[model samples]
Target: MASLSQLIAKPATFSVSTPRTSSGQYRPRRATVQCASSRGGERSEPDAPKHQDRRDPRRARRQCHRHPDVRASRRRRPRRDARRLLLRRRGPSAERQRATCCPPPSSAPAVDFTPPDAASLPLRTRPAAHSVTADYVAKFNAGIAAMKALPPDDPRSFSAQASVHCAYCDGSYSPEGFPGVELQVHNSWLFFPFHRCYLYFFERILGSLVGDPSFAMPFWNWDAPDGMRLPAMYADQSSQLYDPRRDGRHGTPKLIDLDYSGTEPRFTDKQQVDHNLRVMYRQMVSLSPTPSLFFGSAYRAGDDPNQGPGPLENVPHGPVHVWCGDPKQPAREDMGNFYSAGNDPLFYAHHANIDRMWSVWKGIDARRHTDLTDPDWLDASFLFYDETPQLVRIRVRDVLDTGSLRYQYQDVPLPWTAARPTVTRRADSLLAPAAQAAAAAARKAGDFPITLDEATSVTVKRPVAGKRSKAEKASEEEVLVIDGIEVDRDVAAKFDVFVNAEDHGAVGSGGRELAGSFVNVPHRHGHGRGRGRGHGKNGGGIKTKLRLALNEQLEDLKAEDDESVVVTLVPRQGKGKVKIGGVKIELMH
Candidate 1:
């Protein structure tokens, strides 16, 4: 019988050919082949060269397409939209293309979880970063030391626990039935669920080793002003929780920038705190009003990870990782890189806060209080070793309710609740009553829609309504409204949207033309029925909308008289392609 690995290695199909030259010498001509599973049956031009040992099972497995049968079916079926096909072939574009008709293999039933009796399993409330007492800190330290002292081979040991992250995220483990594909948890809808489960087991192990079932991991509440800096408890050099490989400049007392992307302009303490609060407001309340936007792109079984990142994951998530990583190290060792992020004890605390935000967002409104209903999302599963050293599989649906996991975050004030955009009173005064009424009416009507699926610059010409007079142009309230932004699948890709920018490369935080940006959070494809604001049309993907108050930006560009304004879509960190279903330039009252 074949070994487990061999059995899991599915056969990949390829066509073979050998054409002889006219001369005595023989020149072989290879048939062009396409991998059916690669980005929705898109053709892979120029087939690879033939190998000598074609009969070798290992070689065949390596060379075979992920879904050869699907490719055959695609050839038999009619072609799809030429524009969408062209967009896919051109690489990452914002166009929404149809997925392959070949449906993914049915997943196993959702993982089962029988919650222990409330009285038997004590609930643990994670303390706030600023409020943890000295005794609580001591216990936390003791738990870390105990975890580190365990035998290296033990699954609960510090090294073993960290390896779980590397294996799942760093491409060390292949999905159980898909050997050629690596299992990745980041950059998709799985970001929240996977990390939540990981933290669940890690916290359990820590608590078990410390002999305190009620012990809860403290969260690094970077969203709040007081919790911006590294928690004081973790900064002690001698403590087991202290990881030496952290950003040297990020020690306590230095205000943490929530929008940190390597370099940030120095701001006064008060200024930085205000900025952090505004960012929180934008991420939690303003931008993410739906499950798809809040949780990110949906990742289904057998798909590649990192399709897109949710808003929270994009901002504080990736930036926090970059900020915590040691600058001197090549791979940013502990906290910066994906493979080694879990090595830093701080990673858990960081994720705990991310988990906390999910709970908090759910309470914000009725529409936000649910998870995606797609079976591919709900049934998605991952394996992890529990405290008993027995490997266990968990599903996304299992952890939807944090209370079921027997842990909750300590209650804290949400300052972003009152946070508001700091528009100057003078700019506010420019809006005439007639213009304001018109803007409100236009918003309700949903006009001026445009679709974008590529990284290109588009100029929106001001609508020529009988040629606007100078006074009319000055009084007109214009807003760059990006609505119904959706993606075809789960991915962690984001693009920086700019206005009237000369060079995309030169634009940065301080760049004058930088208007705003959007992250295409990961969501599952073919599951487009979303609940809440800016929901996508049925048969489309998950959608969200953004309205950039661009009065000041346009004034800076001196573009009031210009016939059109140029908007550039530049991807951040070279993430994959995404699609924008609709955009509109609204000349509000």
Candidate 2:
């Protein structure tokens, strides 16, 4: 046997090129995920009660899952591969695999998931119902033309008359028209939903501009080595869209993998959906404080940082190709970078993944989807225009009904009772409650780090949270500026919190800091038809007593009827301990 490096240099080319599998064959490709993989550092599952048996059933699932790929290769590699060819002939997706990359033998592209290549999947020639066609650039130009035609301040200004609001508002504005900036949701957690909505509209605009009703948003998966180049728009360096860069490596517009080591490979934008869906498959049932705490960052917690998902909570699971951007003058953007809502085209695809994760999570555990009916929690209402272009008042309830309006995502695998969620043997039961309080609390911490279920992996440069004074208000934009505005940037990276700066980090209080940790509660998934909230027992039914330390004061938070009690973080300037929210007042203020 030659050395490892030598083997790679002279790797043998297959004699038959793996015998062309026909179209419609389910070719399992290597998992390609986008945005952080949904299994995103496990958070505590919604408090699954402990089993006295001291034996974890999840161990059984992992033992069972042992994907057909690993096992087949071990048991009978050649025969199993040959069988795949036969299955392809019988499958419905034989023709579509030409372009898709590196499908795993087991995680094959399913007949259902594959779309007919552009040739077979012709553009509906019958005049598009609306203006946008498949070409986003065309639609963009048209929108510019249309916008120019409209008179100034014609509700169309702001590109579509959008009203940005504090997403963390728990419905305080239901009675008062607008909450005037109800800001308890911590500025740190605000950006995720805001940009999510922003991207939603951008996609609509892109679609409208191109005249293709079926166009979807793309993503910026920078983890892969090939993704380092600048998107086409930025590549030219001639446009105002350029961003400064360093030498040939760091700023070369290439997607940088947080895990520089060569383990789990990164993916392409097109491939990451299913990869993420799988991770989301687990997350749908599992709960973690990561999404709420880190927003779009990576999440983890462990004895060895590298032993788990590492610090990059928003770990890039896919390739670097920009679905859209200034490619020529490449400069990659963080998932939670200085991304303002209105700009950025691929923003929609990024959020599409977020939305999909939401759907997956809801399906896995219905209870996980419901907001804690805590008076403060329910009082939040985020403002967003409906597809009809009317600013409809929405709350956590509104977000729950993703299918209620005009959109639905592409048909992806929806984990049914058959494909039960696995309780990873590697999970720490201790993190469940902490994870629960995390979800309940940081439902809005934009980029703050939470105890990632995988291990305590944190995203860097988190946003901050803090209150604003009445005098500091009046001049700012909305209710967040009313109650308290988020500082909007990583507190660790950019510590400036003054109100007058042109680029104020939106996450207030120097980024949201949650006071919860994960702990085991009850096993809910795969139990029965599942409750309206989850697959097992009701979330409201669980007696979740969370031990939270608001500043220095410690208190145990219990789950109310579909309500989450807000352990509001009150950060005062200068280091001083003070009592404001929650009981047991002696907290680390």
Candidate 3:
């Protein structure tokens, strides 16, 4: 890492292409972004491949995944004509070019960004999707219909807005200073703020189009029992809100399973609902008690993207995406994959709830569960064209408050607060008497950075006693760091983390040892863009980290007084493809 002084001294310049029309053709004028570089060291560009595969139209189609009308456009063109059209447009050397989802640059000159004063904005209330009246639904449908009616060239159009998510998520653009390093918002601390800003502008555009400045989008409140099923408004085929690309099996009357991972559970509807409430309790309370545990690991300039996702992002967030997507489509076309998630009308409503979680998190503990104060996190910025079609730059600091943005969620019942998980048995009984006697010593002596060919476990030392006050120990969280994870991006991988649990320790009713899970729903990536610590063929994998807090879990396991606890890594999805670098416990005071 470079020093703060050295990072501040370097000027960072990013090349921005001209705005593009509906046909994905660039305009004449170009825009450039200039800012103080925060990267510590210079990173060389990735090495080019020796061969290029340009003959296949399937390869080319994957590159254009960001366009919302891609599937429709493909259906319109004949098979032979589509191939010829692609070849004619791309030329022979097109294989060498990198696929990108970068949105059109601003037509105007770039300027330093500053957030508007909070007092200047009027308050607006966002309603729950299930509770909205017919009038509100009609207005929202009209707003979406209006956006879709606009030409794709317009920045405020539905197609352009959807592409914004793809550009930021799918390695389309690089940070201002880091040339080859991709700027991704998903697996880092940038996830919450980035999405907040995106939805803010999107809501504003919809409001302007409908001639209702106070128009607020509805949030799919899937967290509660009554709001568990897909919102009724979105399921109506006659409405513009309906999308045919969703999973047909997950339609209305089917309760959403928060812990869904491709495989369906045989639990009854009541059981599923109860399970979802417990899932919410574990994710929002037990698993995530700190900002770092909730928002995820930090990703600085020049760092590889997908560092790791927070507890909530790894579970219900990821699972909900996979559940809604059509299972038949390759890469689960609409809501499942990152590239095309925004194409579905349900995507915005789904994210509106995610954005709502940010507020609910703060209300849980106003003082302790506040926003991050890191300078790198606060200064990170993005470019977006507002409702007026004027390009404006916004930073993380600009969106720290819902009041400042002039929006508040409709108050609802939080039944999950009382659903905290319980441990039925003792941890020592999970292992044999002899194994328990030597567990700590054997764990301490064992080597780390092991490959996950099978279920792996390690013993991690707890915080030293007498080093801190009792009050500090009670307030501060104990975080488990599973650093330097390497895995293939093409593989559907998932693994659950458990504390002090052996194979025999698993509870039959409710998973007592289960802490949380890390899941990666497979998505297609362009050739030659894969670069990381993994040794996959064609350099196709990612290197990241995962963190989980143990403040409440330790107490449940009756391991708070113990000096060490056995940490287990159970591979539920991709077994041999995962590799873990090391594990340790740190007291975050």
For model 2, what is the error of residue 423's alpha carbon versus the real structure, in angstroms, after optimal superposition? 16
Each prediction's TM-score versus the true structure: 0.62, 0.33, 0.80
**Candidate 3 structure quality by residue, lDDT tens digits, 544-579:** 888888877876776777777787787766788888
Candidates 1 and 3 compared: the better one by lDDT is 3
In model 3, which runs have C-alpha deviations exceeding 4 angstroms? 1-100, 110-121, 175-179, 426-453, 463-470, 502-505, 508-510, 523-528, 531-535
Report the lDDT tens digits of candidate 2 across residue range 1-589: 1111100000000111221111110112111001000121211122222221112335423211111000000011121222211110111122312211111111111111122244432232111112224454344445545533544223233323211211111110100111111111112222233344444544444445445555554432232223333344333344322333312342433333221212233555433433333333222222132233123211110000011111112222112112222223222222122212123323333345545544444454464343333222222233333222333333333343444423544444343223222222122321366544444433232433221122112111111233323333212211101111111111111111111111112222111122321111011111111111121122111111122212111111111111122223323211121111112211111
Off by over 4 Å in 1: 1-112, 175-181, 423-457, 460-495, 498-589
- Candidate 1 lDDT by residue in tens digits, 404-502: 988888888898777744433233322556423433332121232434444556555555433455566445546565555555423344566666555
Best by TM-score: 3
Off by over 4 Å in 2: 1-253, 256-341, 364-379, 385-390, 411-589
How would you order the candidates by lDDT, starting with the best?
3, 1, 2
Q: What is the C-alpha RMSD of each candidate to the true structure, in Å?
A: 14.3, 26.3, 10.8
Clashes of 3: 1
